[model samples]
Target: MASDAVTIQVPGPHGDRDIRVSSPSRVLWPEQGITKLQLAEYMIAVGDAFVLANGHRPVSLQRFSADIDGEAFFSKNPPKGAPDFIRSVPVVYPSGRSHAQLVIDEPAAAVWAVQMNTITFHPWASRAEDTDNPDQFRIDLDPQPETDFRDAVRIAVELRAVMAEAGLTAFIKTSGGRGVHVFAPIEPVHEFLEVRHAVIAAARELERRMPTEVTTSWWKEERGAKVFVDYNQANRDRTMAGAYSARPLALAPVSTPLEWSELSDADPRDFTVLTVPGRLQSVGDPWEHFADDPGDLSTLLQWWERDLGNGLGELPFPPDFPKMPGEPPRVQPSRAKKP
Candidate 1:
């Protein structure tokens, strides 16, 4: 008993615009029975915060053909026949190939993406105008098997203190999974490599502080049960789910932002598409002032240099990337040939 299509009026800075959602009753989240129309409505409800955190950046859309468990693919470039309001900016991928990537500037644009079957949005750390330099310093706290959300929370708190010592303020969010994401707004003066190094420096400091609880090890076998400080997330062309974006999980969980004071009690499961809008109404957006005061990476860069002087050189770059200048071998430690 659902309509074939529905048009939603989404209000933005330019004014209200109507976006049409096709197959409006198609269930995107089978567990919650969340229809495509409901997904579009969710975007409209969180539009402002969504744009503030993800707009004006190169974003890749994760689209699905059926439900959350169905066929999926990532749309990096603007798909053919995109609407006029949906624009794209050129960016270079790690493969050194330049291509135009989509940018969503308003709520209607996000709704339109929902119509295109997009279930998740991955926004790059750098803004569109300056794709080479990052304005955001991001760290993904990935919990290996045997670890859980509570473990990530502890590491995130300590990571916040580490960032504070480096003169940057940290923000926390659920990764829409068992992990956590910590971000800091930074001046877009340095390129992605330098910013990545700064993240490595911070992660190294955190590892030193909580040796048993945290690890910066790139290989999965080396991580054990510790929370991993994923520094690679800061590299060029790398991205994570943007704040307020709904994930493709069965429960329809969202990558919800949080206040530092409330992080300990925040439960990721309670932040699904069905619950987030009400929570936003009651508590307001935690990241409203995220970009109000942008800090530079000078202190972290100095630490990077200090670590370099101490003989801790470059770690391994992702396998697909052209081998970096000082990066260690991409081979797994256990797989490498004996000397």
Candidate 2:
């Protein structure tokens, strides 16, 4: 789209040269097609749309180090620090909407979207809603020290089953890391605090059932053999923003919407920026039929109340949200809990 078009200079150890770039979405192959700085520009441009569409004020991007060769950004003999580049510098947009943005650099992005009812095309897709409302919840699992890849896969399969038992439709994807993110869509009617409570409750229940293989412990040392179930991501301001591909042989690191079955033995790298369009060619936008992803906090809040509460028998999550000064307790002061 014209919105992403830009004329920029590519910087390298040798020298800097002018590069022309623009795209309907992202500048997919910056090293081969553009430069590192150019690709970063594309990331910034698309991200700007992501912000405005989700109800945020555009802000400047922080400068960070990245290597762009003609093949991929941080791929191919990546600089020692390339992997953490995008995240190393914080991305801050002016606050207004409790906006959340999608990560598009991997197939996992699509997989996460498809499993939840929140496909990327929704007005709320790829953006955060209000601090109270979140349209989706993700369970990020960590691998253990001696755990083999198969063990990680097994953990994902079991987690899916647990989510199903909770009446949640969750999809799984390779995190492009040595883990997986299980996504579930909920009605956006509750505040961030309530949804996270429900998430914690649900995660805790799952851990209780699978103490041998799963854990809800925030501290790694306490999590023994079990996979670390990170429900803290459900917190209002917390984000798992997507990362664009910096290399080819490097994992296809994007948010992918996935089928539950695929979670069993799927390759996280199968879905890359290059392959998605082709998959669209045959499968035709895998998430084409779903409603667009939601960014509204109000909707998320309502969903939390309705889906997480129990009526006849047992219950999950506290009925109300925790008082402000939420998570990472040291950061925000709780007026309601002052000593």
Candidate 3:
């Protein structure tokens, strides 16, 4: 091992592998005074849980050149010089084009990602073996201008109840930003569109129950002062930062999972790359039971059909996505009304 890098042998399902971390002292999180080597070590501490949540899935790396706040870009395809141990799986995009995307199957692969200057991990809701059918249902609660984290927490609590009623178990996590993400483990029998509709149904029901606190509005102009349930994130190829993945914030906050009991007082800033390893040691992974019993979306699909009968239909997909069936005109309401 050279003086500038450290070599670690990480045990994986395949075998133990040596990963070299170059420039380990390079400051990745300047504000927190955390170095690239510290980030690599963090992966080893939480590797199992991180792999359990994100491994075997098509993942996109949010990489940086100098530091977390420096020039950043997303890497979907495996980059040049990728190791033989690293693997990729072919997935179809919204445009119907197929491409090979990277898959993280072990802790060593994640450590290698750290070496690649990846600060955040964005894993798909589906595994590599099955890109069309999602085994996880995800919802992103984004706080609008007038609202804040407290508001997002309240909405998350309500969403937990909603998931319970739908016969699904909900897990909560910070977005590594000013929002919350609630996920449910579901059977992979349903495709991405069905999972998306299930999300819409849950969002609409939450809106019905807490009209003042939440909004299902796709248009930002109409979503004032409410936490927008971003159903579009459930679509294929869209991803949220994986749990425990560090963000590009000045503080290098991580997307930490929490038990429902801790959410009320949970602060996203406290879960930084430097602090998370110790926190994990203290509490273990809140999502340790995440895969123990996967639930089916039958009840939620029923809600979807019920909403369809009530004249509520598909919401807008991301603009980049090809115009979907039953999606309303992509133009804004005011603009469309002008013509």
TM-score of each: 0.98, 0.53, 0.96
Per-residue lDDT of candidate 1, residues 103-174 (tens digit): 989888999999999999999999989999999999999999999999999999999999999989898999
Sorted on lDDT, highest at the top, how do the candidates line up? 1, 3, 2
lDDT (0 to 1) per candidate: 0.93, 0.43, 0.92
**Residue pairs clashing, model 1:** none
Question: Which ranges of candidate 1 are over 4 A from the true structure?
Answer: 1-3
Using lDDT as the measure, which candidate wins? 1
Worst 10 contiguous positions by lDDT, candidate 3: 1-10
- From the highest TM-score down, the ranking of the candidates is 1, 3, 2
Clashes of 2: 53
lDDT per residue (tens digit) for residues 1-339 in model 3: 224888877777888889988888889877778888889888988999899989999999999988876899999988899999899999999999999999999999999999998989999999999989999989999999989989999999999999999999999999999999999898899999999999999999999999998999889888989999999999989999999898999988899999989999899889888889999999999998897889999999999999999999889989999989999889777667763
> Per-residue lDDT tens digits of candidate 2, residues 53-167?
2222111121122222122111111123322211111223223333223332222222222212121222221232232455665667767776554566787777667666666
Native RMSD of candidate 2 (Å): 12.3
Taking all chains together, the TM-score of candidate 2 against the true structure is 0.53
Query: Candidate 2: misplaced stretches above 4 Å?
Result: 1-64, 68-131, 243-252, 289-339
Candidate 2 lowest-lDDT run of ten: 69-78
